[model samples]
Target: MSLCQPRPAESGYGSETSLRRHGSMLSLTSAASALSSTSTSSFKKGHRLREKLAEMETFRDILCRQVDTLQKYFDSCADAVSKDEFQRDRVEDDDDDFPTSARPDGEYNHNNNGSKEKLFSPASPKGINGIDFKGEAITFKATTAGILSTLSHCIELMVKREDSWQKRLDKELEKRRKVEDAYKSAVDELKKKSHYGGPDYEEGPNSLINEEEFFDAVEAALDRQDKIEEQSEKVRKPRLTLASPSDAYSTIGTHRFANKVEETVQNHMAYSIQEVGGDANWYYGDLKLLKVYRREVEENGIVLDPLKATHAVKGVTGHEVCHYFWDTAVRLDWETTIENFHVVEKLSDNAIIVYQTHKRVWPASQRDVLYLSAIRMIPPRNENEPDTWLVCNFSVDHDDAPPTNRCVRAKINVAMICQTLVSPPEGDKEISRDNIMCKINYIANVNPGGWAPASVLRAVAKREYPKFLKRFTSYVQEKTAGKPILF
Candidate 1:
């Protein structure tokens, strides 16, 4: 203002544009100072906010993990409580509660000399001998509620059990695989040591085994003998308790289930049945096939008419699959009298059926298969066995996954799996403590009745099953080499 003066132009207020610019610059400088202070405060606030956000995120992670852990515990506890409740309730129901009702007299007492008190009991317990007959109906409702509560408990238990079984099945499969590998390795090592005649073999020309190995083998044999005896004792205890399938009808404990099955059968038939008969394809086809193996069962002559069954076919289907081979046997013979055999048998409670056949169609490879299956007379445990002997087997197929297609779901059940990791069979050794075990090799070597027990078939079914099937199918393709089939 002191140094510069604007030239007048019409009416001078120093040049209007210059004046306006000065004012604008002054306003902008004031605004800049105010904005700078605001920006510093905002930055401080944002920094504190970021720190708080980070802490909250950490807390959230910890909280989430804790919640997940608690949920798992709750789920498990709920299941345990439910199972306990159901068991307690079942025992309670069986022991204490049977549904009871009183018939009405169809009369109301008008007499007021405490007669009404007798007829219509007080709703509230006013005295020692008072009865709340009016609340009887409520008591029934409460009983029903208890049942529902027990049911909820059972549902929780079943869920836990289902999860547990699934895990066990997985674990069992892993254990079995490990055991099979160990077994195979042991056998293969023995074979190598025996046939190849290693340095471990005796130096003498005619020596059967080195002293160390011979002693080891003897010890192993003894241990196996001991284990088998122990197992045999356990089995023998139950052998006496083996009840016949015929006695299933007479058994008093099966009253609930017996009535249920009979009712279902009657409903399916649309008429009441005194005694039910299951599907009879078991014996009808046995007669048709027994004509081939007549010489073997001459001691137990064929009798077919009423088809009285020993074991129930309500659980057998191996006959149908065998019938498939029999119906197709004549057409598929290979070059030799020794047939290339592929055989499949279904297990009692399993969904997957197993098959085994020869690879080379002759010689040591497939020769044993025919020998194994030569006992055409059904195994005693099989349904086709005669009614003269009612034999029951207790061994369960502990391997394999649960059957996806068919399984029991109407009730809850628990099955526990225990695996035994065993050492090699017989070898001579006398050291007492470290290597001693119970005996089982005698049964394995004896090949009881010259036929492998059905248990063996079950054990071998899953492992190497696919390979056997593939090889058999390839063998069949090679054998049937474009021979024209008119069938």
Candidate 2:
């Protein structure tokens, strides 16, 4: 009895039933073919195939019922055969156990007759046909169990497959519903358009309506619009100025200045350390940096020695404060020293060459400088580690963009590092907002070119550095008052 076998057709008036069965078989075949061949790329096609498969559920049920009926009959036959074989073995054992003897003068031994044996007797031979009967029964039961297990497994697989298909069908139906809604909306828009005189309709002159003249005028207007756009595309544009990453940093003395700039920024962002130079003489508020100002002459005519400054402000994260200074487009709005600044060479998204002319101070000539600027963020190593932020600036030369004769070229080296430090309150100390504080470390060494008095230069350095830090933090607080902290 094969589960997959097709039923034989019956004769006479059973032809209708046989035909119905044939039709169901054909439907099953079609459903199987659809399941195999249906493309899943389109939800509509998949949905249609699923509907077709659903229609064959009744046929599947019919086939399952027929298989169940056949299995029951097979089990009943095996049981009856086992019982009959056991009874025959018992009758034969009785005759063998109590054989006819010469007891009581030629009297027949009634117990030895086959009809006198009990159902189960301890006198019978223990090994007499017992092994054969037990083996037969065990074999029959195992075969039956294997068949049922296979059928049950097949049914479970079919059920699981149907469940998966049903889920997919539901999703497809939802998508189709959304599409239909969008189509209806577009149809409504078309109906509104039709209710009016339509896009092409227009009034003519002299109280007379002329559709031909109206259409011609509309075509002429559209042609004029196209010509204007075409002319705009023909205008010449300036080329983009970009710097090479290799030439962005300076190699002077024993140091690769570019690598040092990036390393200093990244290291400070990850952890805090002792100040590099002597303690800052606070010029204003809590803003200060190590400053060395003397009348010194180095290469390229240096009037004043290099200057460096560091400052830390409470509230706002390092990222927020650094972004404000890094943006060149908005620097002119707040910076007082900048006269004109523009990016000359763009090497990467976060790196570029910038040209800027500072406003002249007193009798000293105006100054201009070109530099490569880049920004980067170091991610935290662990959950407890805070994120670090860095902005690097190192002066570079651009032959094509030489300083104007009125402005002296200056050498500038700067690195801005920000570290986000969230400290919990100690004891009963009240906190302001988010327990957030940003430590800003600014390092700058700027040598103003040309001749200038030491007193004048030192005064400018002391005055400018403090003001720069204050204005920057103020800008950050104002901009990020109600905004979310990025970190």
Candidate 3:
């Protein structure tokens, strides 16, 4: 019999048996085809899942979690660093306390060589990938000078991956990693994604089997801080007081001082005069007037205008006559303009008292300030001139330190100056631009104009404007160089 030939079931076997045998073979082939299709479907599904994961932003979420964990770790570690530095300083001090004192007996002898000092270096080792440092020593003053140096060094410590750490960085990193890994694992198991096709991690925080439990643990370990601030004095601030400023001056106060501010102002005035060799607040040229103390020098008085005399000690010009007459009366009468201050607290033999010095810059070099109080060539010769000196009481703000030891600062009043300078023509009232200029020009003494009015000064000094401008600029430059010089 041929193997390829179809067998007639009727020849030797029954037809039902042959049909059943063929049916069984066809069913087996169909099952094999179905199994192959099912395997292919499973393989395609797996490939698609792997591709999706590769493109997905799961790592971004991991990075943020890592950063948050890292931030907490850094904060904790910084506190540890501060405590460690303080302890180190204390240990160093303790070591120093041992015996580095002078020998008994008055002198260090010439023949003896000093004993060598034992050198000690407590160097701070790099912390964890060098992030957490373990009992590392560092320079206390040196480390704080730079802001970023410690941060850079600490970041490297994190990557050190050291197995043994008193406070391990990897342990913290590992915790962060577990958090990320667990999140990823949960995402893999979780099927529902948001409309944005990314996992809404916050919405499914409970997806993690132990998320709440982990969160509670971290919350328990968190750290924090608070501070109290001291208030300062301003215009809006209420009045304050001082009890005994003479004994001890205090920069800070708990409760407000009621009369302290007024006392300080009075003290400021008295102290300013006393500091720079001034006995009393009196202006003398024509005559002398004292407040608490009054003294007068009558000898070698300035002569008044004589009969038709050319270039008399007293000037003939109307303005000159006024000055000459004024000087003679004040000096001859040996009495103070202020009646209450007539008593002499102290008397000076010299007649040239209450003198004022002006700032004069040298022509050759602008920087060279030739602060001349006494005119070298003037008639009544001043003997108390220093080689290099500066004028005192020039700046508007008395707080600024003057350039030269010759200089002192003081505050003057504005109204006194205005009253002395501007004279009304019998009864004319308004202060015109010309009237203001005449008043300023004739004024004998300067009063306290705390900050000079730019408008008024400019208007008054308009004549000889060129000379005034140079003087003003030089004054400004010198003042600005010395202090904060706030406007």
Candidate 4:
């Protein structure tokens, strides 16, 4: 057969075998190509991994060198700080012998040698403790200096605080010493008085009347007078009018004396409204609505204990409360201790001079008082504040009422301050007693000219003050129930 001619047709089995062989050969070639490609890709991946591991090793060596350098630097810094502290402590311990004084500009001078030194020293070329200093060590020295400066300032502040507290402690100690001395003197006087068998040696009609006997007699007289007045009410006529201010017999030294009284009254008002020390300083009443406080005060070397009482009463106005307190006509009616009371002079419509004698308390002489009573309406300090009423009674010297031996003349600085609070009525309704409340601050500073047992006076004050406030408020409520609103 010619080479260019078509091949002869083979048998069917031969042709099938040839086709299977050809198919097997093609499958082998494709699989070989796939294998070669996979090997090349894996080789490249392994090379890249090796390169990354080499880079990691180099970075670790660099980190190790840096850590080593930092550790050495910190170790050196710790050594330097220890040496500096040791040197500073040594210098301080020897300060007494060396005698250094700090200058105003924060430098120190040796008093012994007249040489100056800086408070904070600069870093030197030759480092501290025989070690040489470089760049970072110089920075460390500067930081150490700043820390030391702050510590010095803190020490100075502590010294100043200690001095201030010492002064306050000294003042408190002085006050306590004075109080102790006064108490000792009082005790000695009381002992002598007790040894002399008490103050019953005096001969007078008032001296014979003890507290109980005097009260019994006064009550009987008051009851008889009340009955007589009730029977004579229809036929009684108003008494003659007293001398007018224009026809005054003797004015009450109004220019200077009035000013003094006004000042005393203002002081009393301020003290009455001030807050007491604490619950321990107050003696509470049975009703728990009244608070009473007392403290011994020394004036002109004579000890005087003053009593202060505070209470809030319902169903009353401040004006009514203050009016009843300032009025002399009703003084004996409510003041059960006063045996008799009369007005000596009327300075003005709101001011009067009165003299009153109190019932004798056993073992104590009869007491009387001459005082100027003045009342004023204080306007509200602010728009939101309610009106205030103040009645002040302070002792005064008058020519008509001179001191007598039968009764010891007492000094009184008393003030009654009241504030009215009105709760608004619903829907423009007029305010009534139900909406009114009165706050009362009563202060009584009584100084008996003669000596009386401090314990007796304090006991009487503690027992009688709460009763007086309660009764006084109740009387005002009853008297003003039918009267028009005073506001």
Candidate 5:
């Protein structure tokens, strides 16, 4: 009985030790189970994050492509605007036929003989390149505005989409960061508790994503988008403004008037000085010295008998001759044929609009003329050549001098060009009228509105032109004999 009592204490001690070991094993098992669950969850979360990143990448690519397309469209719109500006400039440059103020009040069409014939009142809008300029301009402006508006809308939509995408990316990044932190903690716990030193205890290469690289890519995309938006803004705002039709027309009309005057002056200066007509149409003149030629020209169903006369006179300066020819004050003094002469308008210091009634030729109606008379000093083409003076007269319509029924309206285009040659007294001496010689080239294209017998017209021209030149030269010499020379 004493031996059995000693065994009971030993059995109790062993039972207690076994209970403690079991408790420790259970604790280790629970920890292992929790680690496994955490790893699985982390893996799933990582997969979801990868998928989200892939979707973001795809969306970024699409957005980038869309931006490129929009950029190309904007470039095309800019090109179109540039082309429209060029076309506008070309149209303005081509407006050289006549100014609106100077345009004849009739439509002109080319006749079979290539002369312009009046058809109807010329008040209708003209076309350029078969397109109405006013309508084209309006359409161009509307189209440009539409293009700009569409671009602005597209840009706004793109920006909104980008902002939405960015917000989603930010949320996904936050969730991924939390998941990564939990996974890292789980891995550390597993490593600390692991008994068998295995590769699974360390962080795996594919477990953690490179967040820095992804963030950089997103930042780059956003930067590019911002740049695109800036460019779009620049394109939307244009520096050059389109002018209204009225302003454009007014500017073009002024240029046209100036251009016409310059062109006419150049044409008159370039006309051949030698006799133009053949022997039959030569009229009476000495070809060697004083050459006078006459020719008949038809224009707009009207006859124009143009006369060309070239002569050289001693004891007269070119300035004196041109001055007397151009001055309205002295016009009637030498122009014996002019009955009533008055200035309709003074265009400038060197230009005036004159209304003149010429003495009626026998068997012909009295002719009244309204014309613009201008005087200019032409610089010599070469330094060695002397300066030339010119007086030009062309028919022009004036509001103040409307065509009257008192006399037949005559159209005349006349030019008297003269050059002076001075012979200096062997040394440097003041030049006198005797030393100066004026070379004159006169062209007169007269259109008598009313019909007269051809024979009478020719005979009258033959007698009148010579007499006019002689009287004009003589009067100029008499007037400028003691006057200061004008160069």
Candidate 6:
């Protein structure tokens, strides 16, 4: 019966039966203790989980009740409005047929007497949550507006939850960082405690398990929140349709245009230095002293040679010349090769999609183009470099207007970039508009869609390009003669 004290027979030399009985009793007692401990721990864990779930359910139920109450109020208000409007209309209809002269002066409209009194009665049926919306004529529009306003409040709550999504992520990251610090500290403490006893001897039972479960729950919640936000973003993307050239190019931002300008300028500069006049096939124009270059490509036995023309004009800055070229109003005065030209769409202040018809060049048929033209002002790379201006015109496709039956659509892709290398002031002379000399570089590469003989195309480029440049600069000079210089 004395559990803690040793048995007298166990201390002395005992019989086999006594020893076996003592061992069996001790084993049974140990098993019972372990089972009781396990059952108590399981019960506590189940109770904690129930508490957490109940708390979440309570919050959800409160939100649902509020929404239900609001819906009931909206329905009651809508019904009240409809009833009032019907009664008012009936009274008005009955009044219309009654003779005006037959009625006595200061007489009440007896037809609507009972209806009007009932309509404005103070006592009415209570709406949801005991709110009375009686006698007040809330129209259909007003009732709908009220419902939407209430809905917006609910949506706003959800929005507030996610508006700080970035902050939530940062907080999660911070928690992870702190967890890592704690883990490192724990490991260091474990190392020190190892010398005294085992690591588990310092920390209580189930401490490690609880820490792991907490971190795992945090990670799962974070992942769920991240996916929710990502889906919300995808759902929130704007659906944009391109209705015009303006919309088409607007889909591409300004940064994209600036990049295109830079690329065109670089290509133009590379050609100016290395490729222009390097080949023997280049032909010179005697009339305007212009150099015209051509390169040929044989595709399906048809020669497609893109042409490039370069010329220098005096007494004008590249800014003025480019500005003159961009002026669509004055283009008819100088660009003689164009039979008709009109801007179909304005994409931006500096960009447009134009429909243009080039005049027939002897043997080659008249060609048209739907192209986007954009102009840009490239600032100096540093204080020492002179400012440059660039104009790029490239073919674009449009659904609203297609190639006409009269002229073939020419596939043209060209960027005509003009650079102004402002000459240094002549020894103490100020930099004035008249004295500033700028070198103009004009490059054009056009591919007339159908097979036009290479010889004819090259000849047209040699003659017409020079004439085009001379007339353009001359027009610029005439227009800007007495006007202030624009840079």
TM-score of each: 0.16, 0.41, 0.12, 0.49, 0.45, 0.44
TM-score of the candidate numbered 6?
A: 0.44
170-227 per-residue lDDT for model 4 (tens digits): 9989999999999998875554344234445322333533445334333454455446
Question: Which is better, 1 or 3, measured by lDDT?
Answer: 1
Instruction: For candidate 2, write residues 389-482 as lDDT tens digits.
Output: 6677878878767877767788877777777887777888765446787877776667776654444455556656666677677667766666
Instruction: Give the whole-model CA lDDT for all candidates, comma-separated.
Output: 0.30, 0.55, 0.26, 0.62, 0.59, 0.56
Candidate 5 lDDT for residue 177: 100
lDDT score for candidate 4 against the true structure: 0.62
CA-only RMSD, every prediction? 43.7, 30.4, 42.4, 36.2, 52.2, 40.6
Collision pairs in model 6: none
Which candidate comes out best when scored by TM-score?
4
Give the number of the best model, judged by lDDT: 4
* Model 5 ranges off by over 4 Å: 1-257, 272-281, 287-289, 298-302
Off by over 4 Å in 4: 1-256, 278-286, 298-303
Between prediction 2 and prediction 5, which has the larger TM-score? 5
**Candidate 2 TM-score, true structure as reference:** 0.41
Worst 10 residues of 4 by lDDT: 124-133
Per residue, candidate 1 scores C-alpha lDDT tens digits across 1-487 of 2112221122222345435544554443344344334434444454343443343343344345434533453454445445545655555565444443434875543323342233223221112122122232333343344334334444555676799899999999999999999999998576435543342342223445544444444345435544654564454421111111333222222322334333332332232111224643322222221110010111122111121111111111222212222222431321122223343433221111222232211001121221111101112345543211111111122233222311111111111111111233357753322322211000011111111223322223222223222333333333333332111
- Over the stretch 1-487, how does candidate 6's per-residue lDDT look in tens digits? 1223221111222335434544543443344344334334444454343443343344344445444655675665566557779989987887787754435676654456677567644433344224212211222223333334334444554565577787899999999999999999997555433423332322223223233333333344335544654565455532222112222322323643456545655676566434454566655444454566666655663445666666666566777777667757666555655778889887667777899887543223457998877766666679887776767787778876698866778766675556565666779986666566656666666666664444544544555566566657766676666555555
Give RMSD (Å) of candidate 6 vs. truth.
Answer: 40.6
Ranking by lDDT: 4, 5, 6, 2, 1, 3
lDDT of 5 by residue, 165-259 (tens): 99999999999999999999997555334412343322123312133322333334335544654565445432222212222211212322456
